[model samples]
Each structure stands twice: as C-alpha cells, then as structure tokens.
Target: EAGVVQSPRYKIIEKKQPVAFWCNPISGHNTLYWYLQNLGQGPELLIRYENEEAVDDSQLPKDRFSAERLKGVDSTLKIQPAELGDSAVYLCASSLGAGGETQYFGPGTRLLVL
Candidate 1:
C-alpha cells in the first residue's frame, strides 16, 4: 500500500557529468513510466514499462539517456554527460495496468546541470 518512492530528490552537476535517478513503483503495479518536464512544459513520456518490458521509449534520448526496470518492480534512469539543457524534473509514475487505471506519480527528482 505504499506509494512510489524516488531518491535524491534534488541533484546538481556541471555539464558533461553523469547523473542517475531511481524510482520504486507502488506494489502490484504492472506499468511504470518515466517522464521529463521542462520549466513550463507538461511532462513528456520518456519511457514506459509494462513489468520488465519497455513498451514505449521513442522519446528517450538514446545518446545520453538510458533506463531499465528490474524484475518489473524498481527502475533507474541515467543521463551521462548531461547537458545544461537537460535541467528539468524527472517524474516516475505507475499504474495497475495500461488501460483505464489511474496512474500515481512520485515526488520527482529535480536535476540541475550547470
């Protein structure tokens, strides 16, 4: 019955550094997602996982960003050589399934690249 959990709520690093974010979705939830939000934009889906399979990841920047869901439970997102333009809020969300279910979101990790 616990909600999603994320670590290192805030992170700051210089450009070209690597930064990672972690997320643990709610129990029993089968669908997990990673999103990115810029200063004034709505969250954009970066990747989506149905259990251990990545169902959607077209928006993810393969050059410097990568993600994985372990055993269909926890997930991690990484950005290597992060660019200054990458400063934004990274959100993690989960739901019971892909259809009709209400998704729950975590507090999110704020990354600042200087």
Candidate 2:
C-alpha cells in the first residue's frame, strides 16, 4: 500500500512571510493529523481530522497558523507572517482511530523560519 506524502522536505523563509505545506494520507485511513515537532522534541498535534470533520485542533496557533483536511483525504497547513520560532518539522500521520492503533507518520516537511 502507498504511504503518506509530503513536500518541501526542507524550506527556508524569512520571518513574517507566508508559507504552506501539503500532505497526502494513506489510503483506507479515516483519521489524519498535522503535528509540529521541534528540533529536539516530540510531535505536538496541531489538528486531528476524522474524514472531513476536525475533531481536535486545540494546539494550533490560530494567531498565525491554519490547517485543513479537505474531502477527508489530503491536508494543508499554512503559516502566515511566519516567525523565527516557527521553524520545525511538520509531521503528518494517519490511522483508523477506532480500535486503538499506532499512527503511521510521514517523512515530514522541515521549515526554517529566519
């Protein structure tokens, strides 16, 4: 089976500029998530989607960040007016989210905000 896909494995941008990343989750999976992981820390979930519903998004920085999982398949995360501290790896994961299973993570998109 195919795995999750992400783009711009690496990125460098000036602070206060806008940036965006994309993700494609695995087939047959009903749950998708977007997470931000610092250089030396574990992933912190930004959003969780079950199909087209955003079941959780409490950790997202709404002031300058936004995300969406459309059609319950693909997802996109955007940062407006990025800041130096926004530099981190954006990880995407998917799972059945029903019977308790491990989440499969993608390679991730690393952002370097200047």
Candidate 3:
C-alpha cells in the first residue's frame, strides 16, 4: 500500500498571499495529523483528525488557517493571507488509530513567505 501523498513539495509566496497544502494519508489509517515545524524545532501538532472528525486543533491558528478531512480519506490545509512567520514545513502523518501507535509521515510541504 502507499505511505502518504502530498503535493507541491515546495512553495514560495509573498506575505499576505494565500497558500494551501494537500495530503492523502495511508490507506486503512484511521487517525491523521497535521503538524508545523519551524527551523530547528520539533514538529508541533496543529490539528489531529480521527477519521473525518477533527479531534484536536487547539494549536491551529483559526483566523488564517483552516483544514478539512473529507470522507475520512484525504485532507487539505489552507493558510490565507499568510505571514512571514508562517514560513515552515507542513507535515502530514497518520496512524492506525488513536492508540499512540507509530505514525507514518509524508514528505512535508515546505512554505516560504517573504
């Protein structure tokens, strides 16, 4: 089976521009996560989805960021009017369930906001 799928591995845009990232998690996985990693920092969970429901999203900036997992399969994350501080790597990961199992990660989407 496939691991995970992400598109546009890299993106560059000026501040105030909108950017979006897409992810398709591993098949049969029931838990999906979106994380943000700044340079030299560990990945921080921005949101977590159990199937099609967002179970954890306290860390996600609601004003300019939005995410959705459709039909419990694929997911998309968007940042509108992005800021320079948003420059980072957006990582997508998935696990079998919400049991703290090993998670498979995708080749993150790197974004640079000038």
Quote each prediction's TM-score: 0.97, 0.95, 0.97
lDDT of 2: 0.91
Please estimate how well model 3 matches the true structure, expressed as its whole-model Cα lDDT.
0.95
User: Model 1 residue 91 lDDT?
Assistant: 96
Tell me the number of clashing residue pairs for each predicted model.
0, 0, 0
Residues 1-114 of candidate 1: C-alpha lDDT, one tens digit per residue: 789999889999999999999999999999999999999899999999999999999999999999999799999999998999999999999999998999899999999999
Q: How close to the true structure is residue 92 of candidate 1, measured as C-alpha lDDT?
A: 98
Candidate 2 per-residue C-alpha lDDT over 1-114 given as tens digits, one digit per residue, 9 for 90 to 100 = 989899879999999999999989899889999999998899999999999898888999899998888788998999998999999999999997845777999999999988
Candidate 2 vs candidate 3: the TM-score winner is 3
List all candidate RMSDs to the true structure: 0.7, 1.0, 0.7
Assess candidate 2 and give its TM-score to the true structure.
0.95
> Which candidate would rank higher by lDDT, 1 or 2?
1
lDDT by residue (tens digit), candidate 3, 1-114: 889899879999999999999999999998999999999999999999999999999999999999999899999999998999999999999999977599899999999999
